[model samples]
Target: MIVMNRFARRAAYFLIIATTMGAVLCTRVLTSVHAQATAPTTDKAVAIMDPTLISRGEYLAKLGDCAGCHTAPKQGAPFAGGLAMGSPFGTIYSTNITPDRQTGIGHYSYAEFERALRDGVAPGGKRLYPAMPYASFTKISDADMLALYAYFMHGVLPVSNRPPETMLPFPFSQRWGLFFWDTAFVRHERFKQDDKRDAQWNRGAYLVQSLGHCGACHTPRGAGFEERGYDESSRLYLTGGANDNWFAPNLTGDLGSGLGRLSPHDIAAFLKSGHGAAVHIVTFGSMVQVVEDSAQYFTDDDLNAIAHYLKSLPAREPSGAYNPQSQKAQEMAVSLKTGDVEHPGAGLYLAFCAKCHQTDGRGVLQKFPALAGNPTVLALDTTSLLRLVIEGGASPQTLNGPPTRKMPAFANQFTDAEIASVLTFVRTSWGNEARPVAKRDVAVLRGKLKK
Candidate 1:
């Protein structure tokens, strides 16, 4: 009887332990769910900072192109954030980055802000979509991060406006799914200086991979639509990809489509001046904004460093031949002259373009880019070409001084069909074999400009 009583006591003890374990597990699950639903709450007062810190922060912000994405082209407010970015998943609107207490990031502590920038997680454990470019931001040094926080918190004016909530399709809408992606791809570490490389190279690498986040546009996306990687090890890095409506050209040393023909000095000159002195190229489309907002502000040393890093990148073969001197090109050029007297494209080119580009399509050196054998002109994607035709662009002032060369906006003068016809002529002529620009494409871009 005594032995049976002892056994019963032991059984009771086991039951109590099991019950305690289950309750603890339930509490943990409930807490996690609650945290996921709520954003971080803060009542801390804004810290007063010195001008030096604020100025540094402002520079960092520009370096990252914060305003380019956060501000709509012609909408609400800067950093109050209502820009709708299109992705394979769906449209994602940028969040208000202003320091407003309720609708913006005014409540974010330095730790919280760092978490969002580096780990792609928000205050409430909510995962940010890859569109935030946290993968690149993750490489930002702690000093820079602190400066950025100071700028946003103390420097800029806060607005109470909250951006529209982003709604993705079914499985994608589940923000929790990003946890796996972050774990698999995003590097949470800070930028490290490579001892083997010179100071300039390392600085360039950090800026390109982290602050500048060049890979965001220049790197090709994988099947999951994430950038392949931000470093030289990845095959897709800097081989070029589309940025919204424009195709960022290959930045590697590829002979045909990339910067193989240009020297490091030429690159630095282009970055500093927004036009190549020796290489025949001009900044337009997104590149124009990059120059105006970011690259133009970089120090001469930093610009050279960036150029050096880009020059050092191993070459990747361009997909297609960029042969303007080939027999096919000569035939196309002949066809342009002979095909149709009433062909709006041919006539337009002869009347509008021949003066600058010359009758043979070989533009004057350093004045106008030649249509033949130019990477921008021969690019498979015709967004820049179309942009140049309809909107017009100008070369930025260089160390040499103010720019006199400018392309006048044709949007006011030409109909969409006329623009398309002229662009189609340019694309087909002089051995350029890119697909013709469509009137619909021109119309869509024009409509956006009006808005």
Candidate 2:
């Protein structure tokens, strides 16, 4: 009996070991695959310095949005690097991008930076994660590339904040796996001018398709993070994208349904200030950072060129903006409760909003947009619109066309239910016709608040 027991115990120990080994193997395999799926191709990051070269690098850095991603929040140093970005996969830490000899890019040569920016390859040929967006930067002109190199080498102060590693699932931790992902998805291409188009259009194309990485946010992603469409070839290009849980609106020429309301100058103005009367609506969510940081810094001519280029793109029909006059909506309109004047939503609106947006639901002219007729009230997905209603409002994107004052958040005064009711009432009232919002959505958004 003792001999038999000893054999059984040994068998059980071996089983545990096998299980653990299998798990480790699976993790490694999966991580490699995940990394490859999103790793940037052709890493070329290097450390080198020349006075003239550094000046050129500065321009490239601005166009590339280097500081926005690499700079730590509220730090006196510029490119010290420690920004934390949240993605569907996990949190990605921006590395030390400064000229610090011991801890930053000081060790890298010009070729290394170029490779990192264009090829997505790090030193020793390790792959960079796709968050760097070198896939887009590869389209930059050689002159612009020199400018960018100059900027990083001299203009920016370097700190010693090495960004943290990403916290992806086990299978995604392997750096080598990023190779496969790049192989399948990444394509190294140069921006070729259309023989028929003018200089402005070509410049806009390069900006949109390359340095700006506009598609990173505006274009939808296919399986494995391959952009659904890289250029105008795909109908899905720049029509919209899902970003940080918010849907970026379509930029196509769908005048009423998409960016049709924006004129070229208006688009330029909006990109400059985040508000304009052409659209007269403000956006929240991740785009707030884009305008506040990168887009606002663009030159007038560049902004105008972008607007003209976008205006020239074809408008595809987006199915989201359903007509509200269907039989179902008409019935719901009749179903609204009439005797709720003293209800929480109505009370809040009367107490706080009546001065500017009258009790009848009409707001002042260009000074204040009428919520009754606003398309924002009529969007099928009310997430952004609801946010605006409860958060007070955002400043108009236009600098000159409209007033720039923004609505403030009201998290302190009204409860979630009250906020929902006010938003629902606006959707159903004064000729607007979108779905009503729920209190739970408000509660969920509330959970995302910093305080």
Q: Tell me, by lDDT, which candidate is best.
A: 1
How far is 370's C-alpha from truth in model 2 (Å)? 6.6
Write model 1 residue lDDT over 4-92, tens digit each, in one string. 56445544543444444454455645654553353323422233276787899998998898887787676567778888988756689
Question: What lDDT does model 1 reach?
Answer: 0.75
Query: After best superposition, candidate 1 residue 150: deviation in angstroms?
Result: 1.8
Q: Rate the local accuracy (lDDT) of all candidates.
A: 0.75, 0.65
| Over 4 Å off, model 2 | 1-56, 317-381, 387-406, 410-420, 427-451
Candidate 1 residue 112 C-alpha distance from true site, Å: 0.7
lDDT per residue as tens, model 2, 337-389:
34336433655666676566665555654455555544445554566665665
Go through the candidates in order and give the C-alpha RMSD of each one to the true structure. Answer: 12.8, 9.6
Number of clashing residue pairs, candidate 1: 0
